[model samples]
Target: MFVPFLIMLREGLEAALIVSLIASYLKRTQRGRWIGVMWIGVLLAAALCLGLGIFINETTGEFPQKEQELFEGIVAVIAVVILTWMVFLDAQSVAQRQSTTGAGSR
Candidate 1:
């Protein structure tokens, strides 16, 4: 329960930060007039996400137990692959930066 609560809090903070950043950028660029448009876009995005989640949940509810397990396992594998890719990319970037700095110092 606490884990889920923390996850929700983190997601809410992320959305808030994104909106704040966008608003700041708009104000700095004198595009404040389009702030309403940005809000509309955000609302639409949120609605779409909610709709997708509902659709997936409802669709999966009809699946057999074995199929549901299989689906979940596939999703977990995909998530692991994506995470691994991200880690490798980050490590490569750090290695590149270190190599460049080392070369520059010599």
Candidate 2:
């Protein structure tokens, strides 16, 4: 219960931040109308993903032992891939800074 709640909270905040960034960018650039469309699309996507998550959780709850293990393993692998990709992407700014500083010192 708490785990799902915390996960949902974090995911929600992250999404809210994304939308905020998009909206802010659009506003600053005088393209607020386009951002409205983008936000609607994002909301639709988030709704779909949430529905899919709920469906997956419900369906997996009915799985038997070995099959459940397989499903769990698959989910874990996908999560690991996504997590690693995110970490790499997040560190990309640091890499840019490192390169910039390294060149400046020469």
**Top model by lDDT, which number?**
1
TM-scores across all candidates? 0.57, 0.51
Candidate 2 Cα deviation (angstroms), residue 68: 10
Per-residue CA lDDT of model 2 for 1-106, tens digit only, reads 9987986786677667556655655674467889769968997998999898799888865678899789878976776676566556545644665686674421
Q: Could you list the CA RMSD of all candidates, in the order they appear? A: 8.2, 6.6
* Candidate 1 C-alpha lDDT tens digits along 1-106: 9987986786677667667766765674468999999999999999999998899888865678899789778976775675566556555655675686674421
| Candidate 2 accuracy as lDDT | 0.69
Which one wins on TM-score?
Answer: 1
